[model samples]
Target: MTDPLLTTAELTAFLARDFEQVKDDFTVDEITAQGIKLRLNVAERHLRPGGTVSGPAMFGLADVGAYLAILSRIGLEALTVTTNCSIDFMRKPIAGKDVICDVRLLKLGRQLAVCDALVFSDGDDRPVARASLTYSIPPK
Candidate 1:
């Protein structure tokens, strides 16, 4: 795979600039040869009534993770938007722990991108959720 167009620091800065509302909740962990690792810094608002992470929160994690991975490869393009997301919540997240998503870009084309993310509670071997996503990329 080619080196990413955006580094972790560059992606972080882009998030801060474009997605200020959620910028504080996520961190770019690392850019691996395979994909990008994103961490969701869980806070009180992210928990559900049963002390598990909310479905919407996990969805956000997966969505943002996928978005960042695509941006890493394609550069910080704000016009790239999620076209579809199908997610499965398989297990409850561990309370008091942050969540991590390992994001992989399945395909990247001039006009579209496909990706997926496996969500796990910090320190867990099993995934709590998984998501497959597609994004529409602006033409070059």
Candidate 2:
């Protein structure tokens, strides 16, 4: 398979013009041929009572990661929107650590893309969660 856009600079530029929340909530830390790295600034709203990252917060990270992965390969296509997401909370994520997602696109076709995420706490390689996402791409 051909490589996608593999640089933080490119990811950020794509996000700025298309995905505004990427500027507000996430940092495109790294991008590579295998996948991409995404960091979430976990704040109070992103925490549960036990000082763990909330489900919605992790969901957002995974969702955005998948979206970015698609854009990385296909270029800026803002109309691509999530159609479905199934997430598994594998472990309790540390509260303060930035949530990271390593996302890979499983399928990229004419009208749809499927992707998955292995989410982790900063400094931890083990995944705290896994999510499979489907996005609908607008007709070009």
Candidate 3:
């Protein structure tokens, strides 16, 4: 297996510098040959009226997790944009719990990267959502 192009510290710094809007919300938990694991700290803003984490919040975590997973292999291609995404909400996420996303890279090619992310509420064994994402890699 090829070595990762970016380390977790490097990715964290890149996100902190470039994507400050979400930098504090996410943490890079691990990087593996297949992909990366990320956590999203849940806040009141991420919850809905029914005391459940909102779907959009979970979607954002999956998207970011997939993006960083691709970047771990392809380097800091900020322009690498999501081309398509399909997310399934498996269950209602616990409102106060953090979300953890485990992303797996299914394919990495010259022009596109395909990945899937499983999102879970922290301390829960079951997944709350699953997302399949496709990202378009920018030309060199």
lDDT, candidate 3, at 10: 99
Better of 1 and 2 by lDDT: 1
Model 1 C-alpha lDDT per residue in residues 15-109, reported as the tens digit of each score: 99989999999999998776799999999999999788899999999999999998898888889999999999999999999999999888888
Which candidate ranks first by lDDT, i.e. highest?
3
Pairs of residues clashing in candidate 1: none
lDDT of 2 by residue, 35-99 (tens): 67788878777898989999998999999899888878877787889999999999999768989
State the local distance difference test value for candidate 2.
Answer: 0.85
For each candidate, give its TM-score against the true structure.
0.97, 0.89, 0.96
Q: What's the CA RMSD of model 2 in angstroms?
A: 1.8
Clash count of each predicted structure? 0, 0, 0
**True-structure lDDT of candidate 1:** 0.92
Per-residue lDDT value at 20 in model 2: 70
Per-residue lDDT for 19-45 in model 3, tens only?
A: 999899999999988999999988888
Please list the residue runs of candidate 1 whose C-alpha ends up more than 4 Å from where it truly belongs after superposition.
none
Local distance difference test, each candidate? 0.92, 0.85, 0.93
Provide the RMSD of all predictions against the true structure, rounded to 1 decimal. 0.9, 1.8, 1.0
